[model samples]
Target: MLKNSMSVEFMAISDNERFARSVAAAFVIGLDPTMEEISEIKTAVSEAVTNAIIHGYNDTGRGRIVMEGTIYEDSVEFRISDEGVGISDIRRAREPLYTGKPEDERSGMGFTIMETFMDSVEVESEKNKGTSIIMTKTVKQVGK
Candidate 1:
């Protein structure tokens, strides 16, 4: 039987994108989530990882993104963290169109996409401590 919560850690590399999403999907599978729900979770995970690589690390080809998943009776929580140049202003980063790298074709929609895909999203960071994004989604049973 799966425990009330399951946690998995992974290094954040561009090549490991699929692996990260797979880990999150596995965690939610235990909750018996629907296909659509699974897709949403995976998308959210992808966005988080992308932000870690592109924004958190500034795409300088340094640092690693750490991802974790926690299962609960009614919800599954996932956190993506990275130790790199942290965001100076999270509020500005979350704006509708606030790309740190606009010239690179970045739409600045990472946080927005994450928030839209997941039920809830929380972000924490310090100047040199790194950044962490926590997201949660409640599972919906098919029948009573």
Candidate 2:
């Protein structure tokens, strides 16, 4: 059962990426996740937030990033969203090492990393609309 839930929206700026990561970390702390789990969640949040700022907003650094979190009895779900240029091809984007912005030295591993660390990931987007990534992770061993 979901015990807690919250959502926050912030500017899609470079500096706010850190804030997003911190928010993700704090949201799941109640589950007493392992350090590694916490790190994985943070990294995933960073990647998602970075994409929203850089790709979603066309590198304009002007937009909004919404992060919603729900805490289950032994799991957590995060939904990151942006009101910017949506993804053209989510499948191609998830391919390993398939960066759309190679010129910018992007690794293009955002979706891959999120999928690797999280138990589930779902993306919904449309041209000129926006994108929302829903990710969930289960903590097999809940701390006391």
Candidate 3:
């Protein structure tokens, strides 16, 4: 069962990445997460949003990114998606330090960071369709 949820759509621009991160942080704040948890969630969200804007849309700033956040009893799920060129290799993309755009100096740590921060990270994509990154983090409920 879902305790709460929110969905927002914004242009795939660099500036909106911060907005996405803020939204995710706000959504999970009620869970009474620690500073480290909040930072982790923000970083994960930033990485996902950055991938959508840079790799997914090729930084054209023309596509749209849909960010969805869902809260459960003990966890929060965030989905960041884009309607642009999709990832061709899910496995390769998830590999640490494996960047699809080496020319851009990208560290290729987006998925890695997301996976490290969240309890689970799932990626769904299709050629010329788009990519969706779904990540979940369970609140530790510290001191509760």
Candidate 4:
């Protein structure tokens, strides 16, 4: 069992999406997570960061994104926040295949993927106040 944490701030640009994932993966190095576990974390982080860049910032790429990761005894928790145009409807946004911009050809699977990969996912936002996504996953499999 290991415990560690790290947080980073970056411009909500498309390219930095990969950077966010990398940082998240790196932060869990102390746990020596399995490849599958690492991949899940990376994928969830990617989806969250992409949402912050796209839906949160409205594709303007002028907002700020804060990503934080913490490692517990057997689980990892991630929280990604953005101070951009918040989601007007939280329930609707969490629905699968629901994208605010269909014109952009988005699949609207961000929240779904995050929830599927992580053990838990929660979203909080106001109409104009900003949004935060918190996700957690157990890194160690049972009897492994």
TM-score of each: 0.90, 0.97, 0.97, 0.94
**What lDDT does candidate 4 reach at residue 41?**
90
Over the stretch 1-144, how does candidate 1's per-residue lDDT look in tens digits?
234665555555676678888888887787888899999999999888888888777877678778877877768889889997888999999997799899999988888888888989999999888999999988895532
Question: What is the C-alpha lDDT profile of model 2 across 27-141, one tens digit per residue?
Answer: 8888999999999999998998898888899789788999999999899999999999999998998898998799999987888999999999999998889999999999765
In candidate 4, what are the lDDT values of residues 1-144, reduced to their tens digit? Answer: 447888899999999999999999888766778888889999999999999899989989798999988888888899999998889888899899999999999999989999999999999887667899999988774345
Local distance difference test, each candidate: 0.83, 0.91, 0.93, 0.89
Candidate 3 CA-lDDT value = 0.93
lDDT of 1: 0.83
Show model 4 residue runs off by greater than 4 Å: 141-144
Candidate 3 or 2, higher lDDT: 3
Error of 4 at 25 (Å): 0.8
Winning candidate number (lDDT): 3
- Name the regions of candidate 2 deviating beyond 4 angstroms: none
TM-score of 3: 0.97
| Candidate with best TM-score | 3
Decreasing lDDT order of the candidates: 3, 2, 4, 1
Runs in model 3 lying further than 4 Å from the true structure: none
